[model samples]
Target: MSLSVWVPIVGLLTLGALFALFSVGIAPIVGPKRFNRAKLEAYECGIEPSPQPVGGGRFPIKFYLTAMLFIIFDIEIIFLFPWAVHFDALGLFGFVEMVLFIGMVSIAYAYEWRRGGLDWD
Candidate 1:
């Protein structure tokens, strides 16, 4: 490929890097300098943070299930965006493949739902 085609990509990358660096560099200078015990402590969604056990206690299985479900749905979105962007080019074969993929994901979701993976109680 010609080097000209890479110019826009390189420009965007440079712009992104500069923006990130600028934000990080400016934050400490312009942001709040006040510090207190509460500000230093770990935040737990606005609730008082609990002390960690000495043994680093195992997390409930529900946490893992929730994380796995998030990953599953995230992957579904990742696949879907590309397919949707190229829908016209992909045609019927792609449509069928996506249908099968969605069906499989749906089955997995149903299985988890039936297994109480979604229940908090």
Candidate 2:
């Protein structure tokens, strides 16, 4: 395109890069330097950490199942946003496509539910 079109694009990219560099570069110098047993220890994945395996050496399958569910729903919601925003313009074709997409996802969800993939111990 023309210089006018490219100028803003280049400026925006440069600004984003500068902001990321500044934030990451300043954090080490300005943030806390203290380190002790707790700080050095592996995080407990949200629960109270101990000097042992985070989940008592046996990881919970529920956590992974929940994470996968979150990702699946998250992606579905992301797709819905664009379709929603352009619903009127997309008309019947878009509606049918979205219905098919939802149907496929629903089938997968039903399969998972039937297979106990959504269940927790």
Highest TM-score among the candidates is held by which one?
Answer: 1
- lDDT by residue (1-121, candidate 1, tens digit) is 8999999999999999999999999999999999999889987533456787423665656767777788879989999999999999999999999999999999878877876788976
Model 1 segments more than 4 A misplaced? 1-11, 43-56, 87-92, 115-121
Provide the TM-score for each candidate, comma-separated: 0.65, 0.62
| lDDT for position 56 in model 2 | 64
lDDT of 1 at 110: 89
33: Cα error in model 1, Å: 2.0
- Top candidate by lDDT: 1
Give each model's whole-structure lDDT: 0.85, 0.82
> In lDDT terms, how accurate is model 2?
0.82
TM-score of 2: 0.62
